[model samples]
Target chain A: MTERLNEDQPIFIQIAELIETSIVEGDRLANEQVPSTNEFAKHYQINPATAAKGINLLVDQGILFKKRGVGMFVTEDAKQIILAKRQERFYTHYVQPLLQEAKRISLTQEQLLDFIKEGFSHED
Target chain B: MKISATDLNKIYKKEQALNHLSLTLEGNKIIGLLGKNGAGKTTLMRLIAGHFQPTSGQLEINGQSPFNHYSITRDVCLIQENYNFYEKFTIDDILKISAVFYPNWNASEAEELVTLFKLKRKRKISALSKGMLSAVGIIVGLASHSPITIFDEPYIGLDASYRSTFYDLLLQSYQEDPRLIILSTHLIDEVSKLFEEVAILHDGKLLLHEKAEDLAENHCIVSGPVKEVDKAIEGKQVLHQSTLLGQKTAILYDQEIDGNYDSLTFSKASIQELFVYLTKEEVVKHGDRN
Candidate 1:
């Protein structure tokens, strides 16, 4: 986790995405208390404010909620919310680019579909 | 604590160390003060720490001048790379003395750090290795708990592992007690992520002062065929450009990168890359005249 952050985007956004990934993978269940901002800062060697900003972004989006002074907790529907969000962006983030690259290589739609099916079989 | 410098200028003899610099920093933040050699990062920090009076302009900490002002100076600790201590004093003696000067200093924390850094209490300051001396400075800076702590290349001779430990300790202490921290180091890549704000100086002048996140977001590198790259960077501020055969790569600043240019590839320029390109551009411009 400490080595995952990169300069490709804002660190805060990456931090947020890491938490979201955990929630989506069910490693963090609903109402589970997340690590405090200070813990994240120390573990990641990042500024506490940057860690707070990332956590606050999740809170603002209803993916996490604060419990006064206790700490932040994963929302009950965090996985659903994250899945919906990613689904909405799937076309632009994944499908559109995949399609563009396929078109660039002159791969027909049928060939692309066949390739994707092969990819799924390999994954299993 | 809030520090505001308006049109600050510092001159040593005929050399201008800082020139017409204005900046404001407030609240709890870890700000990275970045610049090349002799770019006046130390001069600006010294002015803020009340070591030297600015040749001209106002430098105020919480609306009060820091020069010879004990009230402000007590709250600010400026630890330089080559810090000098009484050669006769032991490591414990130095820590005790610092605890007296910095009212907010935590003795227990200092002791823990001393042990962590593996410094002998009875060892005199004059007998320590360069890396050990840097560790002592790190201990003092972290345990001082000053509102405005400034570290100018605080770890000069420390090894890679020690440097990593220093960073971890710095973050841990800052998280325990939030304060305004200004860190100036040439090793920017190792610590760039720890900065909330970044203030870059080039030849005694303020180049840019902005949020670290925004700095990473606003700058990028675009690469492709020379003609495509040229067309993509038209009317944009290109900080640096290089060409190999027909392939061209240019670093763009504060430019909206259009993804519609399918032939071109875009990648975010890291802060260290941006700093190098930005300052190197000035040097190149200066060399052209000579």
Candidate 2:
């Protein structure tokens, strides 16, 4: 289920990220018809123009394509494109923050690496 | 339609309702008219709807005064919280009357909304529950399709599910017919995302009118060591601050937010939080003057 928007960022950017997550999670497959802006606006209780802007951002990124008079669809390589994009942002979005948080708690790099190895060895 | 209010002032007996309020808006966009109770939101909407004239200022819709102007008034619609209807009138009667008054009224849309709200045509206005009455107002507001539509606390008794439904329908209606829509309500957090821009009122005066996203991006709350937080926000406009056990948190409204805070954690300020801080600032300043 889609959660209500948070105050951290603009709704349009969040909408774009929501769609990207759907693609990356295999919920929205490549070449599949994605929800239209109207559908998104109604579902999210947001302005239609804002939803359109989010879709347009994805279209500009070649992850989604608009079929005139029909609706938007994920590109054939949408999942791959999203994966690559997220990989490029991993350091800034997750890894750097993780390391900083570790440093704040006085956890060294070697200790963090060991923890990661232990977690991988024992799956919940 | 272009709606312009210049140096608008409204006085109710000895009380000043609106004080030199000036605003100029054109094009079609959703504007969140937000303020505390008795902050002159109703007065402003009434003036725009021509229900009441400004005591000393000019209010025009499409370059013509709305007061006593049949065409201009017809183009504007203001749905107030307390909807006054003939007590004997049924839901169907109300919709029929509205269809005759509003030039852009959509009968099919009204019928659809009535069904969606589970409103029975034979039910009298006086007998409906508060939520049902609010639903009636929502139906009229959405189906009217006026050039300028203002809703003043239109969802007083609506449930959360119904409120969300209303928001969805509002967006769909707006997309179908682009118009200047102003919503005045205290449910800022719930409806903030739906607004393109917001106009904040405080003490009967316009405090701020800006893009919703831009305002959120510029304002933030930072918490960290007192010295580090103060040093990071030096020379910036701070709205509020608190200190506890050598830790401090400050709300800052700076357009050029320097995200280089090495020792502090920052988060964007919610619209509701900004509204509270801004409105409270006025009270503090007023108390100081007294």
Candidate 3:
């Protein structure tokens, strides 16, 4: 479950998010091997070094553990840990901005409802 | 372990291809060599690879000359866009030749790539398509495991999916063995991400040689108001400034961008946009005595 990222944050951060999302979504389970840095680089069409940096971020965070001769594997509690972390980030990073912008535009509950209704009417 | 070229000069028919350009190409990185058709990119790569004798300059490969020397040539494989192969030789023949040339040649790896690329081993060199030819070139360049692999133009007649596969393969190979890779191509945006360091050549001169991310970070388009942008870029390295309908976008060169300018915010410059801006004709150099 590779995550789709915007061109905003540095790519390595998005790569970490990608692995975390995979674990939380059950796409990547505990003890499963993750793609190597070069694999990720080729898959994402990014620099191999940048890919390694992204994977290393997860390793440093304890969400992933390297097996030396083997490959990188997800930690046991990676799913739950990522879920809680992402949930908090979602609200503060994404939700708050929408609420603040809506408030700034002076859109009340009723007005927003009416606006939605008008948009729906024009679509069909 | 960076590949550094000092006072690189190439003179051909009274026209200097490389005008004493000096650049320190970083190691363990993919560098995007961006330039026009006649720019000194090919010349620079050839000079570094020892394809031709330099008029008066020095190129050290990890501090060595790769020209006409088997020792350096074994560790450095240079592939140009139009590769010259024996027309009668098949893919197997090519592999045999590679075995004699590249000491790090992995036969199994070559076989695996042949299957991955769907290239037939029995096909003649003259009969291969442009895409297939490029694929063979990629296989050789990747499997050579050279310390420095310079690809003049890796993508020729390759479809989108094939090109994507090429990028993936290049990255996958580099992770196992980090080496200096230089790619000269007109398709700047497609391969810009793989570039750790980027060199912009214009009219036989090395215009810019900076880290890929740093190059993007160092310059930005500031557009809002003529007076506002002018004041915003005060004491900054203004690369180029243009006005439209009383609004001006001054392309400023700065190192650190906090991105909280009151008049206008700064966005990262795309490698392609920066190359165009840096190499545009009539644009004065940093300090032109004339």
Candidate 4:
């Protein structure tokens, strides 16, 4: 069976999110070369057109830059840009879900806040 | 290359194989033909390849019927699961014959595929394993370079790694040269990523033909407490539903799901899951009519 990059979303979106995370995590630093569309297609076993679509998402966000005859490279402010975009998504993608789950189990707001603080204190 | 099937009907004696099926496909792109067994996938492929005559209506490739038409037939190649070769012929001999059949056949590419598949060139067709036979079929289908190529369950016995290799080569070759490629397989999840469009046949009729990405985006699954799930999917097209005790999950189609729910979680369904749900709806509809 083909391996899924992420089972919850479309492959192109997953591809874009994957690179965005890598940039935010500093695994792919600014000015470092990113894989070409063909490389991404082969690595993910997806169509090259789909891979191009994913890469284009980053290009549209100004997170990846393309040089003539050379492969794509991370923009100088790619990490910052990704951080900003992800922060915008953080509320819906993480915070809302967290609150919803907390409500589902009848956890009080103060209790949830205390748990979060306790959790952060133990973080390395 | 353009393939048009209008009100196409195929009847095999007493059984109806295709029912007024109509579809128009143009341009060079990969299309996945997905359906349950005996859903007229083979019938459609055979009709397009000129192996079977339609009982009614029409199917034309480039404005000409593919049946016994040498000019159009040469441009269309269909490789079925049980592809036949001379039992005594070696792989090399078969490749030589294929070159004559497919004018644009690439011998070097075939050689490369043979090496990748680790097949002995001189091995007789009868001596190869099932997986090796499937690999040979994939090699010919890819190396043929036909304008419109159809593969019906091409990777039957291929292992996961070999299957991934085939997918890689297929994408690479398609990037190099775009063509109208149709693939019919039950392994929808494995190959859905490569398809630009997907056509589903159900009960000998054209069920759906949608862009693969749009189909995935158009449907979603909502799961949680029975009451919340029911309320969330109210008035929507629920393709399938499963319930256990107080929890329930329903797959909804053509609905925009947003907002945060206290007890419900929404998730996207895989192509295979969507197929099952969609076709299951058809089954339930038929049952209701009965």
Question: Among these predicted structures, which one has the highest lDDT?
Answer: 1
lDDT of 4 at B270: 85
* lDDT of each residue in B1-290, candidate 2, tens digit only: 99898998999767898999898767798899999988888998998888877899888888888888888999888898876567799999999999999999999999999999999999999999999999999999999999998899999899999999998888888988989999999999899878888899887888998887778777878898999998887888889999999999999886445657766787777788899898873446545775
DockQ of each: 0.77, 0.63, 0.39, 0.71
Q: Per-residue alpha-carbon lDDT of model 2 for A11-54, expressed as tens digits?
A: 78888999999889888888888888888877888777778888
Proportion of native contacts kept per candidate: 0.92, 0.64, 0.49, 0.69
Q: What is the lDDT of residue B135 in candidate 1?
A: 90
Cα displacement (angstroms), candidate 2, residue B288, comes to 11
- Candidate 1, residues A1-124, lDDT tens digits: the string is 4457887778888889999988998889999988889888888888888888999999999999999989999999898999999899998778877887898799999999999999999996
Model 3 stretches with alpha carbons more than 4 Å out: A5-9, A16-36, A54-124, B223-228, B240-249, B255-263, B282-290
TM-score of each: 0.92, 0.90, 0.77, 0.90
Residue by residue across B143-207, what tens digits does model 4's lDDT show?
99999999999887889999889888888888888999998999988999888889999988988
Candidate 3 local lDDT, A59-116, one digit each (tens): 8878899999888999987777777788888886665565666787987878877876
- Model 3 chain A scores worst on lDDT over the 10 consecutive residues at A1-10
Stretches off by above 4 angstroms in model 2 are A1-4, A29-31, A75-85, A121-124, B281-290
DockQ score of candidate 2? Answer: 0.63
Q: Least lDDT summed over 10 consecutive residues: which range in candidate 4 chain A?
A: A1-10
Clashing pairs in 2: none
Clash count for candidate 1 is: 0
Model 2 lDDT, residue A1, Cα: 30
Name the runs in model 4 displaced over 4 angstroms. Answer: A1-4, A100-124, B257-262, B281-290
User: Mind giving the per-residue lDDT tens digits that candidate 1 earns over B54-162?
Assistant: 8899999999999999999999998889755777899989998999999999999998988898889999989999998899888888899999999999998999999
